[model samples]
Target: METFSIHPIGYVRERDGSKVLEVLPEYRPALDKLDEWGHVVSVWWFSGSDNPDTRSILRQTRPHQSSPGEAGTFATRSPRRPNPLGLTVAKIDRVDVEQGLVVIDRHDALPDTPLLDIKPYSPGSDRVEAPILPEWAAHWPKSREESAVFDWAKEDGKA
Candidate 1:
């Protein structure tokens, strides 16, 4: 197999209870005009889950109560896959291109997580008007705003 290299262009940070993506000085230029977008797709590394055992996991049994009984790692957003990469669409709260900082509404990645890349969330390409979903997750929130107040614990079988 061919190997490739990946590097962090920034790190996720938490300041005053807000999630922030602090781009490294060298990568600051990349943030130019990023603030024009209302939302961005953040690609980050699941550093905590990166291990031989986790990487070897190919399947998960009932990873989520609202998910299928069993699913391949790829089918579900399991961090324990061949590559522990995380992708999230976060609403932009603020962006300081000069300071190389992007304050986002929310993200699932932990503080200090390595940020790989950021892409503008273009509705033209990213949105699906009538995407199909599995029966189990059909009841989930339809948008990120709704998800913010959603009863996620119930989906995890914790509530």
Candidate 2:
């Protein structure tokens, strides 16, 4: 069978080195041509968190508690789904080759989240006309602190 390898463009500078992850050095140069895309899709690995040890976790999580029926992993945005990959449609806040950084809209990921790869977020292709998201996810309660977490991650590196 043909083989494949996953590479990263750069580490996420979110937590000021507290939660850092290095991208494959070989793919570091690929970022040179990425600046043209204003926003890129960040497909990173959740190196810290994995599928929960419990089998019941596979059942519908929050939706079941609220909706009264267990949902499948694929239907909900549960983290314990198959492959355990985290897909965030993040914006290209900044890119610095010298320091090896790809600053993004930092809220979706945790500090030290492993940098797997980055793809351009193309409005013409990436967007869906009518997204049928689950009922539980239709409304996310955003607070001042929750919304500002990414801002801190994107803060100036020099300052």
lDDT per residue for candidate 2 within 1-159, as digits (tens), equals 575676545555555533333445677676776767877777776655564553235665344333435667677555555456777765566666545666665436676666777778787998766666556544432432354543432322222
Best by TM-score: 1
In model 1, residue pairs whose N, Cα or C atoms come closer than 3 Å (at least 3 residues apart or on different chains), thus clashing, are none
Top model number, lDDT: 1
lDDT of 1 by residue, 1-159 (tens): 898899999999999999999999999999999988999999999999999999999998887886767889888887889999999999999999989999999999999999999999999999998888888889888888899999777777323
Looking at model 2, which ten-residue stretch has the lowest summed lDDT? Answer: 150-159
Candidate 2 Cα errors over 4 Å, as ranges? 1-10, 15-24, 51-57, 64-68, 134-159
lDDT of each: 0.91, 0.58
Q: What is the lDDT of candidate 1?
A: 0.91
lDDT of 2 at 101: 61
Model 1 alpha-carbon drift over 4 Å, by segment: 157-159
Residue 7 of model 2, lDDT score: 51
